[model samples]
Target chain A: MRVAFCFDLDGTLTEEEILPQIAKHVDLYEEIELLTKITMRGLITFSKSFKLRVRLLSTIPIPTVKQTVNTILVNRPLQEFVRNNKSDCFIVTGNLDVWVDEFISREYGCAYFSSRAKVEGDKLIDIEKILDKQEAIHTLRNSYDLIVAVGDGMNDCSMLEQADIGIAFGGVHEPVSTLINIADYVCYDGLALAVLLKSLKQKYGREN
Target chain B: MAGKIDTVIICAAGLGSRLGLDMPKCLVEIGGHPLIYYLLNVLYDVPNIRMVVGFKEDIVMDCVRKIRKDVVFVRNPAYTTTTNSYSLYLGSHDLQVPFLNIDGDMYISRDNYEKFVDKIVPGEDLIGVTLSYTEDAVNVLLDSENRAIGFSREKISNYEWTGIAYLANIKIRKEGLYIYQELEAYLPIQTEEISCFEIDTPQDLEYLSNKMGHL
Candidate 1:
């Protein structure tokens, strides 16, 4: 059965969180710091933070950010495992347009939903069209048999709640308490996640 | 691990008394060259490899001292303590880490060894991975999922000795089971299928040679 698997990008896949990457890329050190503080305090939504942050990083060479994201995502050997178990899985994130579009298509063949980046001419615009991850999962439910969501940030809490099983990746980032408390399991790495999923499919899928 | 097993522990300390050999059977010449010399070169190419040694301590130490000496070594001074379990226990006590254990008497082509060793389950503690019903080998009991329920090297009426390898974690390596009991005391932990094996006689070597093309 196909389990719609939603994923958070920053701490879930890339070892480098998105804001840090934005901070390093655009040289907006002070803005990144302040934005991080607001996000940490739960004062600003991830959408607002992401849009405002990327707006600051709009001047970064698009190719450089895309390349960095691709490099980090592609080093993973999870492609074969995905192929072996692709009957179920999906990627859900709050990352902006070109980064998610190209990165997901090339590295992970699974369908993904991410925030759209407004572009003008050759430069990406600073503002992103924000879509909550929960909204992403809701859209996927029309086509999937089950949904399994994985993420860390507070922004991921709603999407995780929408899924059949939510997994919190505490190894990389401190997940929101709601996600942590409600998640079916918390995995340290892809290794643990894969093993758990394999066991789950065997025990609970189809015939059961 | 990308592969199944967390680590592969080659049992190399058995003294080759049958061959009238001065060195361990692992170090004995299979094709005019020491078997272990070939084994190490092949095993090291795989991701995670370890060694458990016992008899003729200096020889085992010296042979591995030069090449990739970083491998973990578990020594069994009581290698002759009436069972393979003793040697396995002594050598395995310190390794709280999970691993696979191979008998010293057998030989496998590099290709086959990788196929078996690389596919061993991670974190699961199992005694052996024996085969289907056959009187030729010790009838290894199997549960519904094919995990090993029991291992008896004696010619049993049921299961066949797979002659393959076994992957076990630190929990299974817990000291207590006498080698005489073999894998009898350790089979209740299976949450999934345990693969099996069948290597016990000189003829078995001939069989594998025929199967794997004389490695």
Candidate 2:
């Protein structure tokens, strides 16, 4: 049976959140950061907080947003591992595809499922729809025997709960309590996470 | 990023008095092979292997050398006066990276060994445990977080601490004390439950010998 390895983008894959970086360009970093914290802590709905943050940064130029995202560092070891096992890996995020597609999809060459954005010719506009992470895992379940989800925030709880194995990552931010409560394993470093993924693949990858 | 654990310290300095053997405990034959044979075979992937030998060190070294020639031997000359704690301290007193610490007397299945290795998460210290317990087993008590809160010989909890642990660092202020006592100070220590058996008595040897007969 084939296994699907799903990763949360914002704080799990990238060292920092991209929205806050974009907010830096528009002088709204503090406000967006506060909202991000609230959303990550499960104090507010991610869908609501995400829409508000995007609206606050809607006036920023597309080029500046691109440059801001380009400066964000990818978790190098995790990226390398995902690159090596691209056949079964995915990036599942609530971030807009327009903002993250260039780097995550184009450069890293990994498949992704993210919130759709409504853009008007080089200028930011609004979020068209938010991707339900749990639904994403359910869709992948049709083809994969085991789905392992890795994330570190409240928004990732559903995805983690729905997967065969859930790993709460603390490499960037300490995993939120809600996510930790549901995770089968909590990993604090990339090597440990990589080792776990490899072991799972080795154990269940050949069973079916 | 974390690195793979490459070093393993095996404490094999005990005398097999309970088994009524005159040789080192690690050299006792279990199913036509020494106890170290099964241990070394299970740990072959680790790059660095260190063993603490005493109580007929020459014979133990000669026997172990036939299995794996690359092992570095650390001698505990005061094997009569010291316990396994001293042997463990002598084996891993100066190391920076995390390494696995395993007792030499354990007889574990290959599946259980692989499961134990898979349960290891880098950056978190772990103590391998089993749900099955005996009256003489050193049982462990865990909090909600699965951290070892207490350890005792009595049936204090449902989990028994197998003599297997992964230490994140080798720097210790109390070298003479038992490893679990030294580690208890660093609370919230993680635990992993795996199938394992320790060959400590004549009955244990008989039980394992009979168990292996079915295979």
Candidate 3:
């Protein structure tokens, strides 16, 4: 089956976001807010904000994040979706390298595009945009016969609108109405997306 | 109320150190995914499940968390220092009504679970539901009244244990609560007029899985 499955990292596959996980360790709430405003005003790319956030949170302790993320990630249903369709899947997120590299990206063996983090001395630093998500989705729209994009949040709206099948995920944060309006389906559960894609592949997978 | 059984405490605290997995036994693979996933899926079908975790507790919780985020997780802080009954007692309070107890690593079939619970008379004080036992099972003896007499030894009894199910009444619920206050408390309680079923080791797990396949 020539299928492409793309997803939002934090809420789609995980119950919580990486930033909140970092926040649990580092008292970077004030600095994180500053980065959010900077990104909102287009002052810096998402990559920069991610880098700054991780760099600030680096002192919090790597083992804590590693152990916590491993605990948070291990048997997630969202990852099951990706695993069930490993060959055709990809992860598109604004999350950092430490999580994707350590937790999911390799385990599922799927291509993932996300903001890159700066790390030194076992400490994670700023994020630099490694893959512009919108651009990636827009490019993929023409590359595949059918595209399924699953994500939660306003930022995911652009990619969802560009895909043949758009699934608004509520596993993380709820998507904005505008984003939902553009999606073909909105499901509160991540497994529903997996089921939908599985059926889609079964029905049309063998068609020439 | 979140329904009759608002919560369920699955005793997954066993350190299956024999399996030699980096993660816990619950997180080991039976069907490409973790073994705990199978139990959790059938449990979620019940609509109310609170997982009881201890050994590699974080791993077990993390594994279950991805599948159902709203599930209640209670840790048996003294898991390594206790037994299955003790683990259940540690997190028993969250289950207010007659609760269904399950082993975290066993393979479960939804139809069997439904069939067993359906036999329970709605408001009756059914202490426990004991099924016939098979060889390689921890067997229970049934009296004339069908109350569990004691565990069998000389021969495999007429009934074999179906480790896969339970329908505990409130009295047993209270007993379960008090059973672990002292370590030896479990011994006499084990000899009480209690209903018994078996779910302790991998031999039973393989027997049930081979019998039931994946469900």
Residue lDDT tens for model 1, A11-80: 6765556556556766676768778656744678877787677777778777777776765642243344
Model 1 per-residue lDDT tens digits across residues B1-215: 24455556666555545445456766554455555665666566544454556687556655664555445444554566535555565444434456566665555456656555445555655444433533444555667776666656565324554333453533334355544244555555342223322334445434544654554
TM agreement with the true structure for every prediction: 0.48, 0.55, 0.44
Model 2 regions more than 4 Å off: B1-135, B138-162, B165-215
Model 1, runs deviating above 4 Å: A29-34, A37-41, A73-80, A126-128, B1-215
Instruction: Sum up the clashes in candidate 1.
Output: 15
- Please list the C-alpha lDDT of all candidates, in the order they appear: 0.58, 0.80, 0.58
Quote the RMSD, in angstroms, for model 2. 18.8
Computed on C-alphas against the true complex, the DockQ of each candidate is: 0.01, 0.01, 0.02
Give the candidate number with the greatest lDDT: 2
- Sorting all predicted structures by TM-score, with the top scorer first, yields 2, 1, 3
Task: Output the lDDT of residue B204, model 1.
Answer: 45
Ranking by DockQ: 3, 1, 2
- Per-candidate fnat, comma-separated: 0.00, 0.00, 0.00
The docking category that best describes candidate 3 is incorrect
| C-alpha positional error of residue B19 in candidate 3 after TM-score superposition, expressed in Å | 65
Instruction: Point out the higher-scoring one by TM-score: 1 or 2.
Output: 2
